[model samples]
Target: MSDDGDDPGRAGTGEPAPAEVGAKWARDRRNRVFLRRALAGVLVVAVVVVLGFSVRTSRLTDESGAFGPDLAPVMDRIAAENAEVEKNHPGAYVTVVAMFPMTGSLTDIGLNRESIRHGLEGIHLAQVWRNRQPSSPPYVRLLVGSDGPDDWEPTVEAIKARTADEHIVAVTGLGASTGTTRRTVESLSGSGYAMVSAVITSDELTGVRGLARVAALNSEQARAGVVHARKVNPGLKAVVIKDLNPADSYVKTLARFYTGSLADRERVMELSFDSSTRFSGTVLDVIAERVCNSGANTVLYAGRSEQLPALMQALSQRDRCVRPGMTVITGDDASEMNRKADLNMWGDTRIRLFYTALAHPAGLTLPGGEVLTAIRARFAGDDPDAFPRVFPHESLGDGMAIVHHDAMFVALETVKAFAREPDVPSPQDMANMLTSGTVAVEGASGPIRIVEGGARQTKEIPILQLNPDGTSAYSGRITMTDGGPGRS
Candidate 1:
């Protein structure tokens, strides 16, 4: 047993005398393989754990319910009321779907959380307001939905699933002016559902049938900005700074509209940059140089609010233009910009930042604003039935609630108009009327009259003046078409 081998089994055999060395190497190789396997297993476990956690924490986009927990109770309350309507009068109530960005995109920069919340509140108030009316024939019920950032098919399908039972006549609170928004609108329109969007301002959303918008078209907004720029400066020579990102319809249409309108009646210069990447410094500096040397007193910025400060800084700290003061009017996206934190954009310059907003409470003082006068009263805690009862008063300033209320108001009114007809109106009937140039809705934003085929809309465009202290004041409102027609 103590011969010269590591083990007694191999000692007697003439097989190997270096059996101990071979055994040690064999053990070492086995240990190495075991260790590698163990490490690999641990790595796999770690990856699985991380993936599990990510999946658990990620937001579910296809909930087919309220996007936020705070919205659940309000929707539940509406649901209870809907049930009561069904019990009282089975076929009297029609469903209305409110689709806004409740889940997908949220950020801290511009009160996005508050925007969504208030928008929902506005929709709820519209439903309540319409039903509480004494002569209500076709009562309104609400179904709230939101789509994922990438896919909208599920949301559209969900809406379609409820069509038989819910009796959805029209959709309101349609979201922003992006491609997803267009697709959703198109899908719904093709389904014969009338749509009333709260805040879509793209010019390219034409040819879609039965789609109406409470917001002004990009062309109208451009005309407002240009007219204001002319009022600010009589000479009226202007430079346009725009985002060249092709994906965003808001900026593209804004840039196109601005340049087109400016070229028509005034002296115009154009400068642009692609904000899809991080070219804020280099490209903006060059744009600023041209602006400074152009002898133009006005800047029509057709870009998003996030990159506005960079452009402002670029325009600042440069050789002065011959013009005394600079009037800068941005697109509706500037409504989301932070005024206080972004006040440094002025930078000891004569730049006055003005933006065209879809809505403002101050516009209530304009012509035909008394319809929405209750918004002001209720925000002061006046009516328990109207807005600010569910939402905070501070949310009033952002105009999300106002616009949503207006949009829902448009859809509900359209449905009601058909409800009064001889035969019961289906969604197709509502769709026909929404673009028939016959329905005139007085929304909170102003008046919305969708022309034939729903190509355009006439509503008041609110111009908000950005103050030095990083707050905005309602300057004035521009009446599109003298309240003529068309919103899509």
Candidate 2:
């Protein structure tokens, strides 16, 4: 009462009332509580998103069966037939095992599976031909196995085990990567097994007594690519970016051959990175800087298809650094880069990209066209719906499928030749028969000639150019001669 203003509702020295102070404290507490709940909610959402992404990636990389849903029944029938033949006449049936990559880069796994399916169809066609011969031919059965992505040991052991009990005359597939093929070859070297790869293109695999390939050697492909690049831009300065994967010996060999193919008039520079290396912003910046500083009009990339999206992104970011006439050249993996899902990433780049593939042009009147036609007819007659799944309607010109069909054709022919011999040949004898350069089978792609040193003599290579509209066009063709690559 002495005007001290010490009541509970008022401050003692001109401060706010007690009620106002309590209200402000309550509001601050409420705001802090709300903020904490909001933070918790955000953290939960972040975890969920991360987990969902991780699961999706895991599913994509998981190991899959050797055959797709549509083709598994076909394989089952072949297996049953093989069992019956073995029961009736031991060692009378020749078993060919196709080793494919069921898990790895998503694009590769899918392509490998598709190739295997079409290759099996080709074998079926060969079987029909053999049955119609004047004299009965030995039964040929195909079995599929997967080597996964990173390891080939399990698949190798399985092959060895099957060989011990069955008449597995030859081994094929494992062409998804050079490392897989090399490891399989090494495993079967002393084991006396014959291998004819559908797509393995490494020159290093040449001269392996028991191995043959349908696709051109990686070096050959590289030479073709370089020749085409030079033709497009005469006296073009090029910078080659090679992915160094010890497992994929093809990449290293490609880099070496490509750089060597450059003429003296053209300046050349080589750079290397590992397959596992991520193309981060910093890395792309460095690559762009290198290309601009070197004054290179051409950039050649020799690596996996999975890496192309990142490379395209990197290149797009450095559009300012890229010269007006810059072009990118790649190898057979170009189809992977042309996926529809990746259109947005590569469409805006506005850069000229050309890639070389082991393919024959569509609508070409070639000797092997008959075989392809026959195979298609057979597929239509057998299972039309399933045929579309294995041989996708759009994959009439898929180089991988074409090569696989050719490989199967060669393997079937080799087996047919051995079955006709007076005496049953040993596995080593069969291997010799394939690599001896004495057998030639005409296939859908071309003449399947296993020349000296177990190398396929590829006659033509298709070059595809990626347009700004996300469409690919057949730019031209290159022919590989005894000396080098020439325009077709």
Candidate 3:
């Protein structure tokens, strides 16, 4: 090769390499370093995304998480189903609060409300809520007031506080007595919610707009008893031996209705009972004064069954001793009377004690019986029967299961209605739907339609009369001769 000292292509040329070549070399080195760093960063990000996704999926699908030991297995299943429902359908929740009865003469009404009647109906409602939307936020909470065998004040206060902060739409309990329930109802009135009661039997709950009762009204029961008595004994004379004290509002109402400007008005005698003599000499002295002294052949007992033993004790002490042929009719169930205590009606077949059942007529059957059977089958070990067994009357057996099934149906229907409506229904909306006279619901008792006054459908009450053998049977069906002001 020639020396060519000025040639650019020469190894020791005075000129540098081409600008493009120099730039390409530097760019290749930088690109290699950048590629390595970018690859490392991408790998780190990939790992983080996978971990986060795994955590989120686990939380959403895992049954072992979130709900602690407090929820029953059935409740857990319901909750899971509800979660799935809410996931699919946003902005939907079902909430239930039970105001149980506590401390009062009408505590028996509480037992019937909690275990046998309305309280049990509430639990069934949860199942209904879940069934309605098995994959949503089963927004159901039961704040059981500590009224049954415990102090319910704390529970009541806690719920009251929660109500202020939260959007609770419907309420349905505290069926202690009309008074206790009324205390609760009055507190929640105008808060815009509906309360459906199963056993608070007081007729006073009518026309409150948001309150509905599932139990037969006290006035209805009294009228049924009177009609049944009259049907069985045409010669019956009316003598009302009522505890005219303030505690017995049912008696007061009955007195007003029975003595409503009738020609036989003087036949009705009003007796006053005080704290000193609840079922003592006061009740019997009054009974003796009305039936024995005044020649009243038939008498009506409007007091509690607990008072019955004392009344009988006093009657037995009398000189004449509940004279024969003295036909007496009472509203209390003789079958539920103390089996050991002598009611003294054993020989006198003319004397009768009556009561009404909240049962449905024979022909009507509840919906979803087969579905309930299947649910029980799948959860045989888990006791799906917990809600249904609330009404444990073996006499009717499965026939009585209609009560719970119908309650569930009502709850489910309400949930569906809430879901489809343009507005997310507040509690009051649900109450309105339930209490609206237009909604004819088939309930556990019978074809339940809330009349304009918020009372359940009136069934033909069967009059059970006690026989000399200490057993009772339905003498006849009782009908309401008139719908009085006390009735609504």
lDDT of 3 by residue, 229-314 (tens): 56555766666665554544444554554444223643556554542254455656566654565655566665554454445444
The number of the candidate with the highest lDDT is 1
What C-alpha lDDT values do all the predictions have?
0.67, 0.62, 0.46
TM-score, predicted candidate 3 vs. hidden true structure: 0.62
Ranking by lDDT: 1, 2, 3
Runs in model 2 deviating more than 4 A are: 1-92, 104-135, 149-151, 278-282, 320-323, 360-394, 422-424, 467-471
Write model 1 residue lDDT over 1-488, tens digit each, in one string.
Answer: 11000133346666543334334433443455456657866866888788764212112122325456766656666677667766764545677877765545422111255566677777777777777655535666777666445546667777776565456778887677766777788888888887877778787886468887777777778888887777778788888888877667888888888887765557567888887776656888788878887778889998877677777766665757423666789877676752355345557447678888888877655554644454445444457675656554445666777888877877777765543243346678888888888766656665556778674456667788875555788877766674331221
Residue range with the least summed lDDT across 10 consecutive positions in model 3: 1-10
Candidate 1 Cα outliers beyond 4 Å, as residue runs: 1-66, 69-91, 103-111, 263-265, 319-323, 338-346, 366-381, 420-424, 455-457, 482-488
Show pairs that collide, candidate 1: 451-486, 456-486, 456-487, 457-486, 457-487
Summarize candidate 2's per-residue lDDT along 1-488 as a digit string, tens digits.
11111124444667755345434543543455356557866766787788764211111111233346756655654555556654653434456777766556643242444555555555544443443333333555666666665656677776676563345678776655466556668778677778887777667777887887778777888888888887888878888888776667767777777778877667467777776555433564477667766767888887666666566656656655343657888877665544334346553445678887776435244434433444444333345332344435434344555566567667777765543253334567778888887767666555556786677765577788865444567777787877388655
Count clashes in each candidate, considering only residues at least 3 apart in sequence or on different chains. Answer: 5, 1, 18
Model 3 steric clash total: 18
Candidate 2, position 421, lDDT: 50
